[model samples]
Target: MLNHYPLWKYIILILVLLLGCLYAIPNLYGEDPAIQVTGTHGRMINEALLIQIKNALTHEAVQSKSIIWQSGEILVRFMNNELQLKAREIIQKVVGQNYIVALNLVPATPHWLSYFAAKPMKLGLDLRGGVHFLIEVDTDLMMDKIQKQNIETLHTYFNKKNMPYVAINTNDQNRIILRFRDESTCKIAYQSLSSYSPDIVIHKNAYNCLTVDISTDKVYKVREDAVKQNIHILRNRVTQLGLADTLVKRQGDNFIIVELPGIQDTARAKEILSATAMLEFRLVHLQSNIYNSIPNDFDIKETPEGQAVILDRKAILTGNHITNSVANMDEYNQPQVNISLDNIGGNIMATFTKSHIGKVIATLLIEYRDSGKKDARGHSLLEKHEEIINIASIQSPFSNSFRVSGINNIKEARQLSLLLRSGALTAPIRITEERIIGPSMAVQNIKKGLDACIWGLVSSIVFMVLRYKIFGLIATCALLANLVLIVSIMSILPGVTLTMPGIAGIVLTLVVAVDANILINERIKEELRNGRFAQQAIYVGYKEAFSSILDANITTLIKVVILYTVGSGSIQGFAITTAIGIATSMFTSMVGTRAMINLIYGRKRIDRLSI
Candidate 1:
């Protein structure tokens, strides 16, 4: 019976302890994998060399490769011998090709021993320590999109009614005013605009001249939609980046927030956020009016350097043609580009080059920083500037495509290709707000968290053993088993991270597991004193404890899950650890303690078990 036990309780205790031992074996005593490296010693690394090293070390051939920079060494960790050997091969490839020096095989320790020896997992920023950023989204681009949609609708209204326009000008702020040479034509254009601008209330002075104001409420709704869409696209881009445990969600009215832990570079974070995934292809229109190559009356645009600048009538070759692109060298030794086009973009390029073989079609490649730029002439050329690219050679089957020249370096070319592949965003994304956490803060927080957990766990264990004596010892055993299961899950499954709150949850769960055992032991003692036999008392105690166990654990489980679902950043640590602890506690308290009770009742000829 659970209320009283003799020698057999020791056997059940040994078996429970063995289960804990079983879980710990794989993590601690497992063999370390050795990978060989031929060249390159410990130091003297450059950016290009670092890229090659990282690529090699992170290659798929290695299993469970972990890269860490600490104590002036690049640490690599792996599990499989074969994968580690592959890492060696990768190291050989880089070291042999690039540098010459004696090699040292770096040593690595398994992360499981750090509270996760029973269950090992990688450390997150909240544990391992690094910067955490909460970046706010910008909604200016959304406003621009709404204005374009409105402008198009108004343009269609004029074109449909056969109204002639000298020109139409719209501002980035979404205001529209119709301009015409003749007063009568202007009046007619206004009539056409009036039909489409039903929500636009006209504010005119006593004169016939007019001003059309759009509904502010309608514009706000449109801006909200655009912001939501931009958020969606940014989410996709972040997903493509493949960061683990990254958090992204809409913040409210005008912004969304992205939380990236373990990301340290403040400038790099800004660059990633501002990167415009825009792709465009435009038909080159050389400013030939100055040199007599113009068609009819097209005027040439001049630059501040006293040279004629070309323009794109419209994009003819867009980034969509690029199926794949890489920054590699060409035959002539110039930093040129090679593009593999998709069917649509390829067909467009092929058709254009085939039609204009010898003629120099001036296509421009424009460099933008954060957003569109202004030209030296003070014109807003950010949205429309291009570097002039002339087609020199064409290559294709019948479909036809040409290679152009003008890239300066590998980094620039790669950036251009990636931007093109991502495509021009429908609009710009301004950084409305930014928050960055320094590494020193992250490390200090983790240390404080660990201190709290150590004290909480040690105190709980001492209390349990002191209060219930031998039964408390059994509860402690069950708690140990629970800890083992949780750690094994963390180490093997890889979804777990030992964040700060994760330690707190472990401590909290340890107390809960102890509570469950105490309830069962108290019930066993009550039944034995009420004249029930030892075996019957043990059975009834376990049976009565079942419902309470389920109810308490389930309620806590629900709360933990809710925290995981909505809470951001390390709040997720609380969720995962709480959930795992609840699950393991239920098993250790009800099932595990009962099994020990059964073993005791079967062996002893007593009327009571240990309390």
Candidate 2:
């Protein structure tokens, strides 16, 4: 009974090992170089388009390994990267502008394993090799916009409070200038504004002019928030676009670093990642004559169909207040996007609609695009684009939620919904640096790392077998199980990316496991030398070794936790693998080896131990 295990224990161990093997099976199939074709602008992938793509590839004498239509997209696999590249050009020309053809490395997992949602661990950018971008946030523009908004807010506040001010505007230095009739009025206004918020600094000059500026700490906070918001929005955009294994992180005060593993469409990635698109709700100036010179407060804008309309420059609400949006069909079968706003936006919209019943409100879609030109400072210039997407008369006083109709198609509506739901970027961004890692280089790195792990494992197994004989063989089996369990757990967990440093962690973990086995083997030899029976020595050896094994692995886990907490990128990857390895190694080296020893030696009387 000293070395024996219960039936339930054996059953649990068997079940765990079986599940590990089941999940670990997917990694053996590896990946295939492939091309993914997804529709854009509401274009759906139909069988006809699929056939067109196939025919285009065939006409060019590019043989594809397999082509399948799945999840509203077409996946074309190739035996090598050469065919994949050739097929991409052909597919792009065939699909035209309505579709996006992107190079990808898709999993070659079998259908059986996929049915259970078993997948291999995700590879990092260094191993899978896709695209990396360093983007700079336009903090200058963000500050300017914030200042303008603050100026408008102050103007509204002064008007509502009946303050005596001659003019309120921003000057060339980006400071809000408020002119009062006298120095006394300026002092009074300054006190009122200062009491409203501690974030602003107000100065009164001798000429009855007051300078309103943001505090230094507030300015720093605003810039930091803009960069952080952009990082969140970029992550949402990439995820919605179905780019797997994507990473978006802040690099510095005004920069973000994005890594897209297994995605090769740099242009598409750039277009989505840097887009600063938003919607605005503005009142149309129906009384203004479009044929004449427009008023200074109003601007002439156009619809997508080229119809001109006059609109107020100031917006009642912007997309920043939008909390949720969804695309749906109206009673007339027209495409529309239903939008929800936050509390402040809801109150503002309610007040505006209640007074301006029957007035025409327009939904304006604004986008900032690269103008194909650089500024004097060598930065790409952005051209602002505005179009009136929808216009409708107020049917009632609605707040919080509303729908915008007049969309061109379902695709456009869905796209608009996606952008709104993902939240708008606080500032524009430009890609300052870009690097692409080809599939060949990624494969080379993966092969080298894998080779190192495999060789390390084999060497450990040989040493254990030669030193401890049959008991060493038992330890080798546990080691193999530990490896399988680690792979299976990594596969099951989400967002675990395997990197070279992660492989190093796995190697170190194997060494730790071997050390544990050596400790147990040496203890058993000591017990045998003291004239103990084989089975009793085995029991005593394992009993005394558990505490040491637990202590050592717990210490390792403490370091892994610290590394994970303070690290980023590759260091975090290493910590993840080490943590997982420490856990599995503890189990296999002690509980697992004990279970096997119990089955082989627990039931029989022996004169001497093999170890």
Candidate 3:
């Protein structure tokens, strides 16, 4: 029976979904074609060309800028293969200099045009492709921070014990091995350090010399954690940049493959992809008031503590406490930022605001430019010359939802809204690998993938029809339903990049589901031949099929679990579709078959159970 829901409610839901799709469809375009004007190492490796290119593209004045572009691919393979440079000499000369690479004029067609055309994404070497990368996440900086945190314990202890130790400036903060101006002072510093040290095990060797060693395993774990964190942030960052349905997946020990549809805005892609998006909420302390006067660049507000002055930099709250953010307006209607927080964040903001009412708090804002202009020296003047509107008063006392205002116009408002929706990574995310496929490559992949899918489906149908006959048609119906569900899911969901691996996963699941129907049909036939009636055979066939289906699906589910747990990006896609397919398939073949049988023969007197 079709349970009818209220028409109004269903219509509202559909409208919401449709509106969301229309709003987000633009992001599918990916980054624009970056106009190429200069190469660092070639005759093109000079400011003159860059300036000329900028002028030709946008008659506006160019400014100093650092626009990072990506090939949408790793600069080198895990084996350290040097990235192919259009002009190596130009690249070397241009790094940290006033020049930017032009991707539009690059001889190759970019990777994203076909992607926008809704082409299937290509796999990296790790997936359907061949090559793979394994990067060793850098942890020197983190280790150094830990070392400093540990050393500070010694400082606190020494202050009480009157021990003098000299500080040394080393890049690694992990080893805060201070040199005691005198050996006697070392003993006092060591003694003081132990008092506050967490699990400090001081040991003396035969020479009676001190050995200060940290938990190497613990430090290693921290680095590993940092790498994982970095990976997640990188994923978020790439997504935020709207990389045209990009796939940033984990491969092996410490590797990720960023696959694009075609060649991409490699330069800007690199800048956005390579960096981490670290966001912190600093309290604003106003010295130069903004109430009577326009806001200043920087200032400080006196807090009750008097020592810790809040930074005047615009900051209502950090991203951590954000429950849900949407683009909306405020009470006064001056385009204010309206932010609703969770219980914890709400409590904090409420208390802070209540205590400091009628005061100023500017949320610290950082906007990374999608693209920028270059000056005579050929530097990205994105931050210097680019315009950014500061939003405030959005933070409020609610755990439900909120929106930020102060968008001077619709354009700025739209960008900010996208940032919140996609989420700003805790750290800057960079695209280590970027490639924009040309139209030719995209068309080829589309044809190849489509052919494979057609052949697979045809083969499945032939087998099903030949073996089960009438039952095969039923299974085919379920299969079609499965396909519809999968496509519908892909359309409704964001961050779903249809790739070759994803297709393979779907194919694999479809095969498994077909097998379920076949098994049930064969069981029913065996029972009927044993002299059971049609309805009785159907009931028994379904009952017995349950155990086998459970056993099979459970094992397959285990593999999917491992795939999701261990696999990175593309593998994740496989795991997701596979799991969803398994779940939905079971329903169609089992529950759906029962419904069909009931509908077909509610109280029939059918004899032979033949197709």
TM-score of each: 0.64, 0.88, 0.50
TM-score of candidate 2 versus the correct structure, residues matched by position: 0.88
Q: What tens-digit string does per-residue lDDT give for candidate 3 at 81-190?
A: 12223233333343434334433212122344335343222233232221122223435434555666666665676667666656533333233445666666666555
TM-score of 3: 0.50
Error of 1 at 426 (Å): 3.8
Off by over 4 Å in 2: 153-172, 176-198, 202-211, 283-312, 329-335, 354-362, 370-380, 387-396, 406-411
Evaluated with lDDT, which candidate comes out highest? Answer: 2
What tens-digit string does per-residue lDDT give for candidate 2 at 3-49? 99999999999999999999999999888999988765445688999
* By lDDT: ranked, best first: 2, 1, 3
Alpha-carbon RMSD, each predicted model: 10.2, 3.5, 13.3
lDDT of 2 at 204: 74
Against the reference, the lDDT scores of all candidates come to 0.58, 0.86, 0.52
Tens digit per residue, CA lDDT, model 1, 1-611 = 24444657666756755655655455444233433222111123445655666776656545545654442234455665455545656766675643322211222434554353353244566544333434333345455545566667667776887776655546444565556667776676566556665556544322334455567776666667656766665665554443454555676765566765554445535445555444444444544354656554333443222456544455566553555554466786665545677787767766776776554443334433434454464433334333432233333332433455555444445444444444444444445445555445655776686577667667767887787676777777787788787765555555567677787888788888888987888887888889898778777888898888789888999999899999865798878888888987887888676666565456567755556
Clashes of 3: 91
